[model samples]
Target: MSISRFAALALLALPLAACQPNVPQESMTDPQDATEADIARWYIGTIPDDPFDIPQVDTNLLPEEMVRQTVKYNGSEQAGTIVVDIDSRHLYLVQNNGTAVRYGIGVGKQGFSWKGAARVGRKGVWPNWSPTSTMVRIKPDLPRHVKGGLDNPLGARALYLYNGNVDTLFRIHGTNEPWSIGQAVSSGCIRMLNQDVLDLYQRVEVGAPVIVKRTGKRVVANAE
Candidate 1:
């Protein structure tokens, strides 16, 4: 309890405080003021300006809840689990302290919506996209393959879904059509803003659990 001892202890604590996560302060106070540009930025360096240079998200076009924020999570899922509330068009990444990072999302259109538990089978950055045979059948004008770029349907990152060893063909991915967020428009994959998806890509690991809930199912931790 000596003055010099206390001063030394305070000095030692400075570095730890500096190492804390750099969460945005403004978003927490009032998420209604949040915007896609105000949320986290693209972690990777910007791609060169090309014919398909990345488009900026029009915040005015988005719903207030579509932005990112940290909020209390009442669910039983442990930290690192991803819970998609299709009804609300929000995706929650459960954090360690009974909290979760919530991001607005776009769900699948009418008949394409589904509910299930799956795991992250794989991940990709600036992923190439190809219309599935089913997609091609549905939309004959859809291209067979699309190279990875800002214009690609999968914007900046993608987390592929799997049930055990089976590919579910569902993904949590960035979308070029950011205006579609908070809507039911995708075939089945979950779509996020590019910047938001990039942030999520860094946090999620392969084999992490994902729960997609279209109905009012009670959220819970992944079964062991």
Candidate 2:
């Protein structure tokens, strides 16, 4: 069936499930005809040769648009570039074709949001996390260090952003809180689901250009 037709069907069925427990009422909006098979394939619980295991995400609780999928890319960025739209809470990895693999992201909350162009200076697997001094000041009880693991806030992987040799102290990393995807609830970093981050970690390399913008404007990355 056509995408439009499938979306229409999904809309028609939404009211019947609206009152169900743990179902988001607004999920039918921008439906992409995602099936159980798609969810299963995209969010598998195990990884080959990996010591850590991830729990399957309950996609039903998330807005349909937040689920990872290939979408038409209107941006002019070259393939392998990463574009983050803070306003939309979405991140797009540009593909060779006129398309991008979009992932739902949790952006910074209120005063914490930032916009800029940077490079992925480093990459880490199950990266250890240390809350910045500012983060510590904001939350005095927050832990200073968290070991790399399933419980770590920077879940399965991280792509550290930098400007030249200077660390921006910002990252695009996995989140332990899967339900926070597509929400503005972070401390100025881009948060992705663990499974999503694992997929991205394998595709992106260190030094990949990253553009982060808000209000529909593009920020061009500086030459390295």
Q: Which stretches of candidate 2 lie over 4 Å from their true place?
A: 1-22, 25-49, 216-224
Against the correct fold, how does model 1 do in TM-score? 0.72
Residue pairs in collision within model 2 = none
Residue 34 of model 2 has an lDDT of 50
Model 2, position 76: C-alpha lDDT score: 86
TM-score of each: 0.72, 0.76
lDDT of 1 at 29: 20
Tens-digit lDDT track of model 2 for 1-224 = 33234323333433343333554433222224455232232232344425666544556667788888888888889999999988888899999988899988988888888889999999998789999999999889887787887667787889999999999999999875565688777899999987788889899999899999886332322211
| Candidate 1 colliding pairs | none
Q: Who wins the lDDT comparison?
A: 2
- Model 2 lDDT on a 0 to 1 scale: 0.74
